[model samples]
Target: MKKVVLTTSLLAIAAAAQAQSSVTLYGRIDNGIQYENGSPQGHKIAAESGDWGCSWFGMQGSEDIGGGTAVIFQLEGQLNTQNGTSSGALFGRHATVGLTNENYGTFKLGNLGAGELQQDSWALDPQLMQRYAISTLTHGRNWPGIANGFEYTSPKWFGLTLKGQYDLSNNTNWNSGVLPAGQGRSDAIEAIYATGPLEVRVIYDELRSTQGNFNNLYAASRSIMGGGTYTLGPVKLWAGYQHLNAPQASDASVFGTDAVSAANLPGGVSAPTSADHEWGGAAWQVTPAATITGAVYHTNVNHGNGNATMYTLAATYNLSKRTFLYTEAAYLHNSSTSNIDLGNDSWGPNNYNGANNTTSGAGANNPDYGHSMTGVFAGIMTAF
Candidate 1:
């Protein structure tokens, strides 16, 4: 009898303990087909994944530690649903553990979303900087998440919230002079205001590295961005601007507007004089189940590279609360001396950069620079 009573008591305690914490599993799967023209390799058509937002699977949970405090954790990873592969990181997208307090705010450690992505770019852009048309057209392409990161998010006060992030180069004492991961460190600070129908944001981010695994010797990149949104009637309007500067460094080349990966500038070259970007867009909720959005993006690259512009129109139809169908078409214009992705980052087969260059086609991957590219894709997405 005593054993039975003890068992019942322990089971009750277990149930109570479980009630203090909860873990939920969630994810989104997105896939689509795309068509493009004016790539280095000419025209193409194929299926694509993550063209909207990267597909992902993740779990988040929190345990109440005590009064007004909780311990929180999240594990999220990218999924290539079409290829059945990972986004290359075990938890490449997000891997974090943190503490949250109702009044104190939240602090997190480990890999997390970068500043431009979490703080600035997403807030100002209508597309949330996805792999779509506007994303390619904007200078936010440099936005990225980082490893060895720390982030702080402050609670809102008077409609204002502040966030900061630091990425440790993880070098031994931030080793200098062309060391692996010589970027030393990166940082960003952002402020956001939200109330009723108005939202505003300001952000500053920078990167410093020498041996940043780029074709040219690494230097530093800095950016300042500001933007806002207003809600009026059934239409939501957004506008924003970004400026980027990459100066030439001793014994190193300047960074390009597109990318500096081992693939972009194999032999390395001088960076451009400067780059400027501007954009504006609006979303109209035409019905309870549908929305139409359009945006125009432009960029000017100095050093005689000329100008690039992109126009995109997209629509979404909701089949249910958790599922939606979307279609979008984009037109990108590249001056004879300038080549920018019409699909944003890289659409089409061949990839290109700068003004009027061509490269081998990667089947259906990014398009080369120096050519105008146009593309359209329709896809379905679901969240669970």
Candidate 2:
């Protein structure tokens, strides 16, 4: 009888301990079929792993420390669902530990999701923030993330929230000797608001080369952007703009010019200078489990680069709360001096081997100026 009593007492203690902590595992798998036109090698079709959010799995846990405070940790990784392979990164997506306060906010250290830039994009895009569709066309794919740094997110104040992040060089040799190739600092600041049917955001992000190179060529890049969304019933509207600039290249870095050739560039045959981008979109919740999306994006670069424009439309039908079937179409039209491809988010010829000129180990391909691209894709996604 005494032993039974002791066992019950120990079990009660274990249950209490478990109540103070919790962990969850989550994942998503997406796959689809895609086709594109205007490829340098001609038309093509293929199956792809997809949805704007890459296929990934993650685990997160939290421990309550009393006093409205808790400790949190997460580990996530991207994977290719088509063939069951890692995205070449063990935990390429995230590996973070942080602290959260009920009234104060949250702070994190390690590889993070950066600022609120990505969340802001969802409001300003109708395609559910597809990476290659609306967002990439307007904003260059330069989210460095917090590789070796910290992030802070403030508690919401009347629908307003603030987030900031800094990426540091993990190296120890700083003031004494030569710096590493990518050993510079990257940082971002963002502000966001969400109130009933309205949402808004502003963000600033920058990266600087540590080499102290000359001629501003690939020396640094910066982005300043603002946008918001408004919803009326089942329909949501979005609008936003961004300004981006990269310093000019020097004589020693003239080879960098080859990276941005006539085919891919707006006008300048050299490295990127400054560019302006604008975008808008609409999302219609046609039914309780179905949605339609459409968006338009445009960009103009200095140095005779001219401009480029892209249009995208898509639809999603939910099989259940955790699964869906989707179809989408996209088109890209470039000015006489600009070369931008379309259907990048979907897959196939349009993005991989379009009309751009590229060599082995060369920079990304550029579509031929004045050329047009179009594509369509169908896919499904499931979350667990």
Candidate 3:
């Protein structure tokens, strides 16, 4: 009887080991060719789609514990296929570990995407193959850094959830008379949400930076976004809205434009400023394999600075579950007489020029007139 009991105990241990949990490796490689136009100088054609999709690979794992508890972890990194270099910082995309319990909630640490952003992932414009694809340049806002941070997500209650994150700057030194080295440098947030056929999300962020003595800048940014998609057989329709506010501007000369300094202060002085932005869009599925999307984005800056309006349209055709072709274009108009131009910095040149070639005296060296951006992309993506 004792020998039989020992054998049974060994078998039970083996079974527990097998049932603990597992890890898996996964990733996607998306590439394509693109042609862009509307430069102040003219138009040019280069590599269409090399680093656009920003191909990447990652690993994820979870371990099951008794009584509905488990530990989970994910380490993802971006890859620049064009030149075969590290995406940026280590685990620039995401690096996180956490725990979850069916009867409780979840807690995570390390670099991770905001749950507020993920809430709308499913309702994004369908015409765009990759919403943030470097080549397309016609989709959502980009916040790439996943620095040191921690997050908590509550268990869903009646199809609703809550989540938040805090990022540490880890800086200790501050310039004399400044807000302090890490005063507003760290990233912090709070968010709330609900889901189902319709979903809503609200996110608040704090950003801070210090200049020289007697000069510092701090801003509180907040976004309220909501959208939903309802499917009717094989077709679905979706729409969303986002509102953003930046209440504090930089006072350092190095951070302000020559134009703003000269016009807003004495002897080209600098002070704090504010800005607000609103964005909305819609998407429609023309067929099971094709989609069309449209969006309008508007920005209003304080101090008679100026405003900008952008309209975008795009279409995508899925050749298969893993392959697709897409095209997108955008037209932006700087309507503010303040000569303030806020152009897209992710793709080409930075800064916006005024209508009459009046330099806003902004960062680097901005021209007088702001131009438009139009692009077309034809490529394929594969995932495994």
User: Order of candidates by lDDT, top first?
Assistant: 1, 2, 3
Ranking by TM-score: 2, 1, 3
- lDDT (10s digit) by residue, model 2, range 96-177: 8999996999998886642324444555666766644655553333333336658889999999999888766555633111
lDDT of 1 by residue, 267-341 (tens): 332335456888999999999999999988888866555678888889889999999998888878866555566
Native-to-model Cα distance after best TM-score fit, residue 173 in candidate 3, in Å: 6.1
Clashes, model 2? 7
TM-scores of all candidate predictions against the true structure: 0.86, 0.86, 0.74
Model 3's TM-score against the true structure = 0.74
Candidate 3, residues 1-384, lDDT tens digits: the string is: 999999999999988877798888887766666555554443445443332255778888889877888999988777665566666555657788999997689998876642223323333433332432211221123232335567777888887676666665555542211222123334434343445455554544443444322122122233444444555554545554444433444443323444443443322223324445555566677888987777766665544445666566777788898767666665556542422322323211123221233322223222233334455555665666
- Model 1 scores a TM of 0.86
lDDT of 3 at 70: 90
lDDT value for candidate 3? 0.50
In angstroms, give how far residue 210 of model 3 lies from its true place.
4.1
